[model samples]
Target chain A: MASPKILIIGGGPAGLSAAQDITDAGGEAILVEQEGFLGGTPKRLHYSLLAPDLKPVEEVLDPLIDSVQQSGARCMTGAKVESVNSGRNGFTVTISGGGKKVEEKVDAVVVATGFAHWDPHKKYEYAYGVYPDVIDFKDFEKMLSDGNIVRPSNGQVPRRVAWLLCVGSRDRQVGKFYCCRLGCAVSIKQAMEVRRINPAIDTYVYYMDIRTYGFWEDKLYWKSMEEFGVKYIRGRIGSINRGEDGRLIAMAEDTILQRPSEVPLDMVVLATGMEASEGTRETAAMLGLELEEHGFVKPLESDSMPVSTAVPGVFVCGTATGPKAIPDSITEGSAAAIKALNYVRKRSIKVQARA
Target chain B: MPIHEKNLIEKEDLLEKEKAVVDGVDVSGRWNTFIRERLLSDYHEDFVEEVKSLPGGRTVTNCWQCGTCTSGCCLHTDYGLREFNPRYFIYLAQIGNVDELKKYGDVIWRCISCNKCVERCPKGVKVEEVVHNIDEVLRRRGVTEDTPGSRWDRTYLDNIMATGVLDELGLTLKYVRAEKPEDFTRGFMARMAVKIIRNGNIRTGPIRRRTRGWKKMKKVAEDILERDGYASAK
Candidate 1:
């Protein structure tokens, strides 16, 4: 039988990893990404270092992207998967770009449309978009990668910084109840980086719970405290505004002391959480895949069959299913690749038996 | 609008001019209260390290401030003392904010050792031990003074070390004499001394009686207390 073709819709850690794994396993893979580049959010944001390990982004993603490119899998950049129509032979997929449309026949589909950073502006009290000194995780990553820890307001090294966790995640007022899962570690990592950039900055993280779940509870959160002196205060930020000194002032009740504390800082970092990206939403709609309440692609059985989507011959992985870390996304990418490859094998068998 | 959680602001920081006029405009009382802005704390950076050096304080850093320990605290649920929250105290100590621990020094001693916090704590913080250690540190730093009850305990323990058995009469006399010189004129110690003589409950004599085998065990008890960071009686 000819090589089974698999369509991987995304070019992120998960999509790239899936494409690499499938091609390495002797299955033909076609990778599609909407951006002109292939490296997903980390590349788009120019992420300097990843969390938990603090490895340079290029060390991990660069090789993954390169390996997938060299694996002989057809790759499409700056294009979108317009539609998918299933038939007895397999799926007829439409790709549209540059006012052109191309069709391909694929044995299976893997939707790895990753997540988007939650918009901090939704919590208007934070003054994320309005204030020049305030920035979210996405913007901070880019700023950090640019190698300057200066306030946008004056471009001076910040003397005091405050990281407010749970800006847009774990907040019912915004209709999002699930924990962002990555913010605590991300905030801790950023706080460490800020302090490393300038040892004098008094960095404080105000949080209700430092949910640095998994091994990160010690590796990232506690080490950030013992090694870097990044102070942790049990307080939820009430609001942020410009003070008389042109510095940002954050108001919070240091719940430990049961007294309100007004923290004056040169910069305020909102550890914004992740949500379903627009691509994730659009792909789900186009493919007739079920989405959970949070709009992430619904799995066949999230606990046991996590990579299998609601539609047969279709698989989903990474933040496309929910908010997850880079390592987990990559793992799910390989997992989805294996499932897609198996489905193709079974399809060829069915066709041969029918003949 | 500026966020002023007025209820959470300290009472002393809310300074207001009662019934005053400023520039032909009335600015007085709660209507024009001034909320004092707090400065960043230099934090006793070694506070957690100091606590860990003491007995029963090693796990203080394990706290994540989940409040699970506080939710099941008997001192909070039964005694109705809101200041006796284990989670809050642990967080304060962890942050090295000794200034904030001032208001909570006395309450730390009130821990009943119900161990509810230890059982409920997901981080394995020995909550009961941390509470006692905080009390110990407060007393050592003179943030808290010896209450009459604590003074009585000191006298009682002194008598125990002197003699294997507890001498109630010696305990009473020692406690009375150890009272402040000014306390002699008008205090429970003065009244108690007078009652002891008036009733002839004790013969006026030296506390020469010492329990047998006390020397061997007294050394052990003193060793334990010293090792636990309590080198003195009170």
Candidate 2:
């Protein structure tokens, strides 16, 4: 029997990992990335470090990028899956990119299209777009990567900085009820980075909860407070205004003290939550895959089979399924790849038995 | 203990008689002990707005009652004055529970104005100022009587107004005489004064000439105070 072909949409960490797994399992894999680059949000945002251990992001991503390159998986960057159609034997996926359309037959499909950061502007209380100093996590990561962590309004090293967590998640006003899982850890990591850059720089994290749930991540959260002295204030900010010095002034009731407090900060970093990417929604619709309320492709059963989608030959993984950290996404990527490979192997075995 | 855990049963609110009879039924001891049931029907819905109008009370509406201010407060941490919860007081003031707020009159003055609560408050509630604002509201509503803290505050302000600078020795003497006469020459105050005198920082005669432009400065201060509806020049 011919090598069973599997189409893995999204050339992100999940898609690349899945593709590498499929090729290793002796199944032909086709990885399609909509962007010109292979790496997804992390690469696009220039995330310099990973959380929990503060390892360089390149240490994790570089190997996956290299694996996808050397695994002989047919990789297509700048390609979009315009549509997908089910046939009697398998599935046909049409790709549109480079001013041309190409069609391919794959026995199975894996959707690994990840998420987009929630736009901080939607939460007007933060004065995100209106105030130059108010930036989102992605922008802060980029600024850190570029070594230009200064006030955007005046390019001065900010002495006082604040991180406002739950900018969009767990906010009923914004219609996002789910907690963006990685936000807390990411904020702590970034705050630690701020201290590393300048110990004199005062960093604060204003949060409803410090939800670094796992034991290791919880330790990192403590390290951020005890070692780095990143002050954690338990209150969600209500309003932000510009100070006379062009500093951002945040107003909130210090819930602990039950009194209104205002602090002048050089910059305010909104730890914006993750939302389903446009591609995830589009792909789910085109493939006729079930999507959860938040629009990520729904798994067959979240507990029992997280990587399997409702569709027989289709699988889902990573942030494309829901908000997850990089490690979980990679693990889900491999899980989805195994599911897809099994589907392909079963189909091939059936064909052989019929022959 | 958090402010919520504060003992609401005050001595004045308790009615206990060693021997008593009610409606020809013998009631005595435990049976005669009747503790007042605290009920709050008066909600100052606009109390939060009133406090917000004050200089440091503008952010009272932003408080979600998280208690971060109390946990981060230096006074609460160092002294564990559970009754000195800034957060709970803000809640009471926001809801306009004046009766409940009156109960906190004593420890409310214990705030040292360290601004740790201010620095750590995520909501930027201007905690120190909010505490002041709460006190101001209490003073206006006659919920709190003039305590030594308020007396000392008046003395300090009067000294500053008169001399355009803090007259530490004069203010201390006046404060001691007016507020705590018994402690005027006892304990910490006496020891500190002797140390100062020995250190030669204490001047013997009348205070040096008033700060430069004392008259002009006092006039400006009085004008502002009068405009703000505060008694000008005491």
On DockQ, the candidate that comes out on top is 1
Candidate 1 true-interface contact recovery: 0.10
The digit string of per-residue lDDT tens for model 1 on A183-241 reads 99989998889878877777888898888888997889888875676878888988997
DockQ, Cα level, model 1: 0.12
CA-lDDT, candidates in order? 0.84, 0.82
**Candidate 2 chain B — worst ten consecutive residues by lDDT sum?**
B37-46
Candidate 2, A117-227: lDDT as tens digits: 999888888888898899999999999888778989888898888899998999999999999998898888999999998987878788888789886444667677546
The per-residue C-alpha lDDT of model 2 at residue A93 equals: 83
**Model 1 chain A weakest lDDT span, ten residues long:** A255-264
Candidate closest to the true structure, highest lDDT: 1
Give TM-scores for every candidate, taking all chains together and pairing residue i with residue i. Answer: 0.71, 0.64
The deviation in Å at residue B91 for candidate 1 is 4.4
